[model samples]
Target chain A: MKRNVVSLTIAVLFLTLAVTGVMGFFLPFNILTVSVHALLGFVFIGSIALHLKNNFRQLKNYFTSKTALLVILCVAALVAVILLQPKPVLAILGLSKNLGPAADRFELKDTKMIYNYTPAPHYKMQLNFKGGRAFDAEKPPRVAIWLENTSRYHLKTLYHSKAPDAQQMLPYWHYKKSEYEKYKAESEAAEKAGKKQSEDVDALSSATPNESFDPADYIVPKDPEKETPYRLLIEINAPDDGNEHYPDQPSLVYVVEVDNKHPRSYQVLDLVGYPKSEMDEEEGEIEWSLLYADGTITTAHDLFDSALLLIERSDPIK
Target chain B: MKRHFFVISLLMLISVWVFFAIKAGEEKTSYQSFQGNIFGTRYQVQYHAHEQLDMDAAEIQAQVEKLLQRIDKIASTWKANSEISRYNRAVAKDEFQLSDELREIITLSEQLKTSTGGAFDIHHQGEEIDVSAIAKGYAVDRIAEYLHDELAIQNFLVEIGGEVKARGHNAKAEPWKVAIYIPPSHSHIVGPRVTLSNTSIATSGLYFRENHIKNAETGHAPDHDLLSCSVIHPSNTTADALATALYVMGAEAGLAWADQNEVEAIFIKSDGSIIKSVQAQR
Candidate 1:
């Protein structure tokens, strides 16, 4: 009886040590998980081997009775795995994931070795090219201060070695300090007043006027300086400004930009209608609306100031 | 007996573990940097800086330097006694005995002139066949090829002036983006993100190198309506030649020529409007 009691105590202690070792690891107060596991494993192996050796006949009968249960459990688990993991079969047929429209993955390539990249920065600018709805066709162009950077800094760090050195870097510009104060009233005057993102990409590297940050927006000009490479971007404004005067609405409009390789004056090359279904065959023409710094408004056929280009992919894909 | 055996085994195991723990602390990676002269310019080359030195970089640089010196010797009109000077004095009299590099430029120039229909040409003026406009592009391509093939560099970017060739993904797997500056004020970018890879992009702008873009057959230098024109091609030399040609031809014929030749291009009209080749837009 004393031997039985000692064995029972030892088995209980062994199980307790195994559970404790598995649950606890690396804490200052419980750092002996590995050591405990090692000792318990040694004890468990010896004790189990001896117990089975003493009960060999009973162990054989127990396994024979549990065979059907073990087989059923394995089959059920296999079925569950098959149902949940249909991707392998779908992929085999090449019919797996069909990411919807605007699901393109952009792949950029380095273009440094082909040019005689002087110890001077090259410019590639992307800007906003805005457009008005069909109800407002006669808005004409504006003498807008477009945003542009002379610095040819890339967004990716991996290409830093290939990028032009600081001596050869281009120039950059940012949005106005009081752009909201200057344009808020004018924007409110529009029939469907909307939020406008700042056009200054330099704003990203520099400190903002306020904590306010939003993407830039532009309306297409009747004539965009054509001799330069300019990109464009557009931001949609909410009607009420949503309690915040310059809220960045969830929606976006259009993007504009020119290639920075050749910087020159601005002109509009082509324009396309919004929403393909509602697109009119106007030969991609746009009337510009000028909202300038001096509060006075006059529209024209072209727009080219500090900014010239912008680029963006369609939603999800972007 | 069992207690003695356990103590002996424990001591042996601890000694082996202590030895391994001490040895692991000594492992580390080594690095090195290299520098040299090539094409009459100095190059500071940095690599993983392993113990194994690359003989190819030194050999290739030497080869390139000699080629440049030879080209300089022949291309200068002032060196009346040299091969290039004599050729410049009377290009019609002699089919010049040229080196392999010079021959490649000559053939490429003629081929581009024929195919892009004058949008890519190296002129034979008076006595010299001037491939000056396209030289940098070719240099970049050749140097890049040497680095990739001979030296086995997988991720590298090389530039010759404004022309550039890039290969391999960025360390972060992002495509390499190039920026181009607007001319007149060549300090600012007309746009910021121009993406390219494994190929070359060259831009010719009115902001630099006056009178180099005159009409070849007529020599009539029209007022440039293009602030800049860039051609993206399989090679830097082709892009360089194409950029010059497109700038001379303007948007109308230049685009048609690009399409017919199947090279990608972007032309910036003097008014700041841009026209991109279908391939580039794609």
Candidate 2:
């Protein structure tokens, strides 16, 4: 009975360790995976320890003769395998020592981590609400509160995912994909006929670029059904006089109106959502909600363009 | 009989020790590489060592190259005889059969696209979201699997482009030293150092790639005001995709998304300002 119980315990412990170790892959960001893996590791160690203790007499007998040779060989093989394991793990994870193991082993203590990668100052800004009635239909449908680049250089285009209701297809999105084929055909015909149709086509295509930026370039589906969020593509250029930061900025700023009933025209100076001190600008995307009369709150491109949109939008190459 | 058995066992131990000791002495370094062709790009794997367990350099490189070629054959925009090329050209619209590589990348991309709200879209046309940025990391992972599972490699580092992964310690018993190239303006690689081990790191800023993050879908400066974005993730694919997406998204949304996802990222705004993830500093 004791022998059977011991076997059952050994089997249970082995099963538990294996199951926990395998579960580690899916629960990568989850802390429980680590805990489970650690627990399993302890169980494995304990199992081996107890088993070795129980087999002490057999181990002694084996060591006295050829059995010892086989045991040593098995251990050597296991060691080789263990030693060989790390390379594949690193490769599979695309991990290197440069990134440091602590990143995976631990999480950042505080959520307010920051760094100084760039050489310039910034006007970090944020508003107080979530994505609320910010997308209410107003004269100009509201987006997150933002500022205008009135900085010196010519304006450039900007792109981002907007709110669900606020999402509007740019004029370009109206064109059926067949339009590209038609344009391509004309251009090709012009090339074959030795005419200036190519230039004309290029001119037509480049027409809206200098004046209006289209948001279709950064289109992303809200769902597989094809609904998408609002995005604005801006185009601006600054002369490269060897400046590190561009003087030109987004000529336009679209802020989500706070009033669900009457979203107001959002302007930078009127944007009191973020603390004045944090309202510095370099060039990046940031989410800003309005505390307007409407109280329309929304997340600004919470995903793709969120980071870029997290900072102020700038046009110049800077 | 007992004495004979003892003598044989001792000899066996000595032989095992001699073989391993010699191997250990000869094993100075190991590396991992990926070689494959996808989207007209040829990828190759090389240099992963696991203390002399099934070390075959040429074969691993060949396998990686073969996988790359296979991907090229299936990628819808792979330029030539590649499957993607036909799909993009509208010639073989029905030929959009997804291969294993395509399916894997697409699945990963779709997951990221939804999670990041299209910030890291793999299906993005115009500059076409090439998985190249993240493929290296995947290749590293694959190489690791091949070595550990197939060949039993234990200690090594793998990298392609600027992304990297490493395991175990170097000859001096130190973690692998991966060097990050400073922005072109800087004279050396001294600034903005991030030390890592047993993890993957990737940078998707225009610092490299000839600043090619323009929006082909809109003929506009896609990365307006954003210089670069580097993301580090437990998964290299996530890091790579996020890096590119965040760079394309520019600064604001990049930082915002980083904050939201609890991801460690660093963004360089167009004006040369850097915004780092709260997680990265820690």
Candidate 3:
């Protein structure tokens, strides 16, 4: 009776391990399956030991036989094959590791920004404005603040002056706005035609808000955790500010490429260049580009005393 | 005898190879995925159809988004005109009228509050009723139901802000697997992974450095050693609420409560040790 009970326990434990092991292979990485398999495996080993001790006389005879040698060799070969971790077995294991939803796993490359506080409702961009020597209360410079990807694609206009000539005053922003409008029109036309449209245009159109100068319209990213490196451009131009270069000085554009991956508390915008456009000789198309500021930019440089962009979070790091 | 043993081993290897080949052949269905921002977070839905799907992925995404927007309109506190917001703004009275959706959610929250011994509460002292904690889970459950009933989708997984509800199997015809993430910081360290079919899993963690979850009884964030708590149940709403309640209850009481209630839970402590409830161990 004692021998039968011990042998039965071994059989039951072996069956349980086999079922759980197969489940562990086919199913996702389940904690319960792993725990049960691991806990029972130890008990299975103990039961095997008891069985060997109970039938020691018969087991010793089988150990010296050729059949026992063949079984030992087969088991050893199986262990060696698994321990080698061949490509096929490794690939199978990789599938088990990826058994969950893609969203559940976080890749190191996904974390581009580290904020002091939670990204949403806390991360903000604060621009400190100081009046320059050429600052006039009656005719303030038409300022446009916008973000652009590294490829110089206009993402969204954060703030734009509500003046009627605001578009004309900021020629670079006007060119980008026209380009965006053209893309938007094309995307809508494509959508209406039931044809696949460029996702870039859709993303841009959705992010670009309606033309409204409400204070509430000046909204930053609600969550900046996934934000990549982008150029923050500020275009300022005073109408009729003529200099030696031409009858009117072109708008001055200030740029600062903010990379959330490597963040800083504050960054000063550097004057990159002004928008320079020329009529194409062959196609009669206007080509818009940026030109370095020359001696003609006199008062345009003084449009702001010092524009500083401060990155602020609700809770500062100690 | 030697020849017999060699032949038997060769036959065993061939049988194993054929079994794997058949399994690989059956896993041919491709999954359709839809993802968008919802409820101040992100949501994803993945499903595969054994038969023809009535709508394309985009149309299904629009329907899901509409459903989630309706729920947001009912429960979102950030929206000034939401149903819950209106209820919060109303003067304290013996009775107040609420929309059916709001009433259902509020009723569910009240039930959870009692079941958890006041560990989970939408109403805080001098604070507006915020159902944001349970809203995502509810949205997930609703989307899963819509996929099953309206679309006739048998295999689907819905996740909103980490709250997940999976029904049937994946495209591979295996149970859907979900990974639990380490909390307080968004890291690559994955905790326990659970496989499910017609089940939901919700994890609540101290996401911010500042205490975010508050105990309804004391109206203060409980100081506990728990880094995160994950609950598994048939209902995402219950799982989501219990995850928060368990976090407030801490590790010891939470483990006991889970076992007593026969709720499946996994608690990760501050010292990085894990404790599984009795049901979860099985």
- Winner of 2 and 3 under lDDT: 3
What is the Cα-based TM-score of model 1?
A: 0.39
| Candidates ranked by TM-score | 3, 2, 1
In angstroms, give how far residue B127 of model 3 lies from its true place.
7.2
lDDT of 1: 0.45
Which stretches of model 2 miss by more than 4 angstroms?
A1-318, B1-25, B29-48, B76-78, B90-95, B124-134, B215-218, B223-225, B268-274
Off by over 4 Å in 1: A1-318, B1-83, B90-95, B124-127, B171-173, B184-189
Q: Sort all candidates by lDDT, best to worst.
A: 3, 1, 2
Weakest ten-residue segment in model 1 chain B by summed lDDT: B41-50
lDDT of residue A116 for candidate 2: 12
Highest-lDDT candidate: 3
Predicted candidate 3, C-alpha RMSD: 26.2
lDDT of 2 by residue, A1-318 (tens): 255665677788778767765555433334675677687677667767777777789888879998789989999987785455454533443322122212212111122111111101111222222222212212222222211211111111122224353222222221212233333354344233322222221010000001011111112111112111122222111111122232311112323212111212222222223111122143342223222322221222111121122222221111
Task: Indicate the TM-score of model 3.
Answer: 0.46
Q: In candidate 1, what are the lDDT values of residues A133-173, reduced to their tens digit?
A: 31122322211122221111111111111223211111111
Where is the poorest 10-residue window by lDDT in model 3 chain A? A200-209
